[model samples]
Target: MQKIAIIDYNMGNLHSVERAVSHAAAGNATVAITSDPDMILKADRVVFPGQGAARDCMRELETRGMAEVVREVIQTKPFLGICMGMQVLMQHSEENGGIECLGLYEGNVRYFGTVHQDIGVRLKIPQMGWNQVWQQMEHPLWKGIPDGARFYFVHSYYVEPQTPDLIAGSTEYGISYASAIARDNVFAIQAHPEKSADDGLKLLGNFVAWQP
Candidate 1:
């Protein structure tokens, strides 16, 4: 049986993610929530779930000495990143007074500040709530999920992948930003599939069966 590890760095919603992934696995694989680099390395797949500020996330990752382990996992295994987990994979972030990130791909995380697509109709920051995700490219993780599926989102910053072609999905808030990115064995999203109901569960299930 396959072993899947959810890298833990004291982020919020780790249990929800764990439960959702467990249900998704359907007894097909074993799942573990761990900070131990050896276990992560030993697992067949890894899920990087995060919440809260970028600075805090990075601090915890570095403090726990798991940043390099995360860096190593993404390149070698089927990796899934959620929310702030997705943000830190970029080159830099405009959050927490400008923080440096993992730079797994060429991108930067930017905050939504006074963005208005319509006149005088301001959208809230942290964009808390459900939003529709438009799939940008075809991939196994998106299998059985509609092209424009709505997912749960709660965040103030979004990612901007330098390579446009790498964007797997996008969502329109005050503006349209890369909500999901995919490359090789890595797939990351800004939405929390655990709270997304049916579509969200489907995504988790797909990830378990995803070969790439």
Candidate 2:
């Protein structure tokens, strides 16, 4: 059976993530929420899930000695980063003045400001609902999920990857922005698949079965 580690840094309610992933795995894998670097490194796949502030997330990761562990595992493991997990993979974030992230990908997370608008309606910050994701690149994580599928999202921030080719998916609030990124064995998404219903569940199931 596969061993999956959901790296815990006390950022968000991991219970939902755990339940969703567990439902997806369906007893075929052993899913664990662990902060121990050794256990994370030993897992067949590692999931990084987070919410709340980037500064707090980064601080926890660095202080707990998990930051370097994440950097090390990225090169070899099948890694999945969700929400703040995905944001931290970037070089920086414009949240809380400015935050330095894990820098796995060269990008910056920016807040959705008042300048954003769509169809004469002022787009809201936090974007607290569903938006359609357009596939930006072919990747394992997109398997069985149709292009332009709607995923649940709740964030005031978004990512802009320096390398365009690293983008796996895009979504438009006021402008087109990356919602997912992929490279090598790493795939990270800004939206929460756990709250996304059917398509969300399908995506999680794909991750559970993905060979890449």
How do the predictions measure up, each by TM-score?
0.96, 0.95
Q: lDDT tens digits, residues 1-212, model 2?
A: 99999999888878899899999889999889999999999999988999999999999998899999999998998888999989999999999999988888888998887335333556777888899999988877788899999999989999999989999999988888999999888988999999999888888888888887
Candidate 2 segments exceeding 4 Å error? 114-121
lDDT string for model 1 (143-207, tens) is 99998999999998889999999899999886788999999999999999999999999999999
| CA error at residue 55 for candidate 1, angstroms | 0.2
Pairs with steric clashes in candidate 2: none
- Residue 175 CA displacement from its true place in model 2, Å: 0.6
CA lDDT scores, all candidates in order: 0.92, 0.89
Supply every candidate's count of residue pairs whose N, Cα or C atoms clash at under 3 angstroms.
Answer: 0, 0
For model 2, state the Cα shift of residue 145 in Å.
Answer: 1.0
Q: Which 10-residue window in model 2 sums to the lowest lDDT?
A: 114-123
Error of 2 at 33 (Å): 0.7
lDDT of 1: 0.92
